[model samples]
Target: MLHGIDLRLPRGRWTAVVGPNGAGKTTLLKALAHLLPHEGSVRLLGREAAAWRPRERARALAWLGQAEAGAEDLLARDVVMLGRLPHQDWLGVPSPADHAAVDAAMSETQCQAWRDRALGQLSGGERQRVLLARALAVGAPLLLMDEPLAHLDPPHQADWIALVRRHVARGGTAVSVLHEISLALQADDVLVLQAGRLLHHGPSRDPATHRALEAVFDHRIAVHAVGSQFVALPQLQLGSDSNSLATSPSED
Candidate 1:
């Protein structure tokens, strides 16, 4: 349902999609991926996204969606091997290149240690990392993820950021829908949506971007600077009386 939206995401960078619930963030990604029908045009790498053949598109973009489901009996390595399907023939034979890519991706995501573990036996965070490895194994120029931090703890979330940074640094592009405002702020650019409309799109540090983000949230949240990074905090509402127990100075 998004409208009046026009964005040209840069290559070799990260663009984070942020918005309140029902803001159509996921819809936007689906549209860009050609998974949904939309009126407007979506161009990837200078060509219409829909113009590419399905297998060609699959080779060009890697996707990691929220709540990825897989067979519980499958081992982690087998799941990761699925990312190489685009390069495989109809029989899905793994080539030497595919094996190397999977190996590297597993090592990068730190999933190699559990490569033989059944996906059902892994913890949520562990499973998340394995899924991320699968996405990375695709070796596509662009990667799209929805709520990729779903089951990751704080440290692993940070690790995810670092992994994406490394990817972009190596000339890869990443677009992700992130609920964590602080993590979103780490992206090179931010696309803020509100109720199916494009509210703002700009560098994350731009003052205008911060203002639009605050306004979209109805001023209930405030963006602050902690050292070099930005943090979003809940705006505390104080009583007009100015002497409420919550606000009153406490005696030792």
Candidate 2:
């Protein structure tokens, strides 16, 4: 349902997409990846999206969806290896490079410990890490992840952030849909969407981006600087007056 949208993602950087529920964040990601049908043309790597062959597109763009269903029967390692499909010959066995990629991804996500287990047997957080590893195994320059932090503990979520930072530093581009405003603000840039429209796209530190974020959420949250980071705090409306209930000590 997005309208009149035109975006140019910066190369070799991370962009976080944020908005309230049903704001077309997920739909935007899907359209960018060409996973769903859309009216306007989507160009990837400066080429028309539809013109790229399926395998070529798959190798260029890796996807991790929100709570994807029905891979429970597969072993964790096997699931991650699926990301190597684009590089392997049809019906061929996994190559050394493929195995290496899978191993490295699992290790990066700290899921190698349970690589032998089936997806159905793991905890929510564990499965999330495995799926994250799967996405990483793709080794695509552009990654599109929807709600990648789901079910991760605080430590793992921090680890995810660090991983993304490293990916960008190493010259990869990534776009993610995130509900965690603090983490979203950590991204190099933030793209704000609302009611099927693009509200803002700019550096996360930009005051204008902060304003758009606050406005889109109906000012229920306040954005403030905490140390070197910008955080969104809830505003408790008390009659005619409003006060932030979650402001950090430093920002207070």
Q: Which candidate is the best by TM-score?
A: 2
lDDT of 1 by residue, 130-217 (tens): 9999999999999999999988999889889999999999999999999888789999998999989999999999988889878877
lDDT of 2 by residue, 1-252 (tens): 898888999889899999988899999999999999999889998899999999999999999998887478899999999999999999999999999999999999999999999999999999999999999999999999999999999999999999998898899999999988988999999999998899999999999999998898888788999998999987765554355334322110
Worst window of 10 by summed lDDT in candidate 1: 243-252
Q: Could you estimate the TM-score for every candidate?
A: 0.93, 0.94
Against the true structure, candidate 1 reaches a TM-score of 0.93
Name the runs in model 1 displaced over 4 angstroms.
238-252
RMSD of each: 4.8, 3.7
Checking candidate 2 for backbone clashes, the offending pairs are none
| lDDT over C-alpha atoms for residue 123 of model 1 | 96
